[model samples]
Target: MTLLYIHIPFCDSKCHYCSFNSYVDKFELKSAYMEALKLQLQADLGRFEIGPGDILSVFIGGGTPSTIDPALYEPIFKELWPYLQKGAEITTEANPNSATSSWLCGMKALGVNRISFGVQSFFDDKLKLLGRAHRAKDAIDAVENAKNAGFERISVDLIYATSLDTPKRVEAEIAMAHKLPITHLSAYELIIEEGTPFEKSPNVKKESIEQSRRVIQSAKDAGLEQYEISNFGDPCRHNVGYWEYRPYLGIGSGAVGRIEKERHYPHGILEEYIENPHFKKIETLTDEEILEEKIFLGLRSDVGVDEKILPAQMLQRAYLLAKEGKLRTREGGFYNPDYLLSDEIALFMLG
Candidate 1:
């Protein structure tokens, strides 16, 4: 079975720290882009030789999926309905500002069972600092509307480690999230990406290990298990699939897909993708590169790496780390207990 990711490159407004391939002025191209998306999906389904009931999960992410009308998503869903496995996890990301009751209901009717709201912070000042269009009340209302629309698996994305974030403030953020009827929470540290507004003021991101621990402890105290670094509560199957190195079909401009050792990238330019959605730039992965990814991705999450996949030298290092209590060995796989040290541990194993 394969996973599917559909990207919507339209946003109501761009956030200060967002460097994702999205545009606020391209609303007029929404219909044509979605149609092209269908064309690409049809071609990919055939090319990938996917059979009925082979799709394991579907994640509709984007510039902001809530920005597009649900009516435009009907045809795409119709095409995918035949291939979706029973009880498949279908998710869509939304911005609290645009995900209204009608929008939430419309997506629910089209087989989206999960909603992940981009509610960065609950404080109005913090929201303004992050350039978010919605206020705290809007986020609360949006999540409530989603629940009212019959969504049970709701997730909220929060950003921490911002200039305005303190340990107390981070705890309050997680507390606010806990008050919501959410099954999952993703607490990310603010990373100033290049070409974004935050890039101009790198100090906007205040990296504090204390804040990170506070966020994690707060979520765990609230009964949201820390399955992965920055992720708490019920695990997102699509995200887990990615960490497990499962092949997924990426549909839409600026999206990516991986099949076996090959990674595929469609045209990033919106208009170019609309002109030829089937066109893709392919990159073949070497054995070393694949192993590196398995090591890093596995170490970062609960998906431990199989010992058989590691070379002799790396396996020896893993065993050493396990002996030192930095890593845990279970069922012939090696797991990292402290996800924050994942990068350092992976580097050691690689070296």
Candidate 2:
């Protein structure tokens, strides 16, 4: 099965810790960018030999896809509808402040079955400190609006481990999230990315690793399953598609796609993409590299690698890990309980 990813690199404002290829001053290029995205999608239909019933999901992520007028998505949707499988999960990421009632309604009407809000936190003070444009109330309102717009699969993002994220604060956030009409929760730790505002004068003081574990336990107690390291149920299908090594088509600036072992990356510059949609660099992954990804990605999520693909030595390693209580065997593969150790496990097995 294949997945489709569309990137919208426009945001009303940039967050302090964000290093994404988003721009606030490129509003004038929005229309052209959308046009280019469509062209790129059209190009993929030809280049990848993809047709109807091939795509399992479509995820439109961004610098804030909510900032773009929902109407702009119509053209691309119309082009993709003929090829969309029945019940395909179509998702779009929106910022709480920008995803108003009308925008949410329009997206829902346009076949967006799932909505993920970039609600970094449900606390106003933390939101402000994170350079988020929305307040806590706005996040609540936005989720309510999405629910009213008929989105049953809704998700929200949360960041923890900052100095401001006390145990009490994390509990409060989890409690609030559990009460919301969301089916998914993506909890992440604050990282001071290079070239980001947080990297220069980082105001964030990280909470202890134990605090992070507590946050995960809290979400699980609230009934959200930890399907991945940082993501809780209802985990987006597009995310699972990646861990399972499902091929996908990537459209728009900074989007990457993989067809079998071949990887495709389009021009990252908005203007450059608009100028030439087909300008992309392609790379083919070696069999060894693909095998490594299977182990690395499988150990990080609920999707486990195929035991049939494991070498005798790696199978022994997994058996040892199981004996150590670090791994479990199920679904004809081995899974790790501690995702943090996934990389190390994969490396050890690779050796």
Candidate 3:
């Protein structure tokens, strides 16, 4: 019941709203990085004594993993291929501009089953404003290439905020997404992360709450249902493990893994290569903490907490919300509201 994540910390360029631990340079060290990752995996398995179990999922996220030549990926895949069982989910994050026909086909042949593209916006203006290197056309082309190459599960990541983002714009974006051959969609609200250029811009959407709601409604209309507060997909299996708080492993530079015994594993640097991979920290969530997390995350999805186990206080809150026509019980649990931003108001009200 563990998940493995590999973080490729190199990218061709950094986006304006990005706060993740990724950089635009140091891809030259990818070969060394791969060697270190292999050593790290071997050492980790030894320390953990992970049995010959299914590799539940492998996620290779990046500054830009697609930018690295597939030849460098060969060794890592060779070592990992042995551990994979049938139905194991493997996902990679690729930038639209970096994705091409050849790259998609090569990874698929190697059993890479899923791809999540970074397609922030369809409008060229939004793309430029976000500092994305790919235009909407590139996104269209990438998804088509992936489908033609036999990828069955594809997810696209989008961002919303700023002056140009309106309910109409959000609807339009989702409408455009419907034309593409993708199975999943993960849309996020704009957050002015620290040290990013957007933090200094006065044009940032401080009060775009209404606009956010419209955007989400647009997505639902397109049949991309909301599974979590920020993420939307089929929803993808990777997200199920994540939202359900299932166990997983994290590898590569700056990657984080939460294992048993309250331990976390991280690959510290993209600059230096190591024969053996190690972690910077392992965080433990207390019993109370895990309970709280379940409530927080569960409430964000369309299917909220099971009524049987829901806290008495939460049930009371739900009662009040239902009375107000803001919450409704369904087959799984409870739905907050039909609107997109309802989750936010629900969280605040319930909190």
Candidate 2 C-alpha lDDT tens digits along 26-46: 799999999999998998888
The TM-scores, one per candidate, come to 0.99, 0.97, 0.88
Give all candidates' CA lDDT scores.
Answer: 0.94, 0.89, 0.75
| Cα lDDT of model 3 by residue, 64-180, tens digit | 779876777787888776676568898988999988899998888878899999998999999998989989999999999999999999988888876677777788888888789
Task: State in Å the error of residue 274, model 1.
Answer: 0.5
TM-score preference between candidates 2 and 3, better one: 2
Q: Give model 2's TM-score versus the native structure.
A: 0.97
Pairs that clash in candidate 2: 163-205
Q: Candidate 1 residues 1-351, lDDT tens each?
A: 999999999998889999999999978999999999999999999999999999999999998999999999999999999999999999999999899999999999999999999999999999999999999999999999999999999999999988899878889999999999999999998988989999999888898777788888999999998888889999999999999999999999978999999999999999999999999999999999999999999999999899999989999999999999999999999999988888999999999
In order of TM-score, best first, we have 1, 2, 3
Full ranking by lDDT: 1, 2, 3
Clashing pairs in 1: none
- Of 1 and 2, the candidate ahead on lDDT is 1
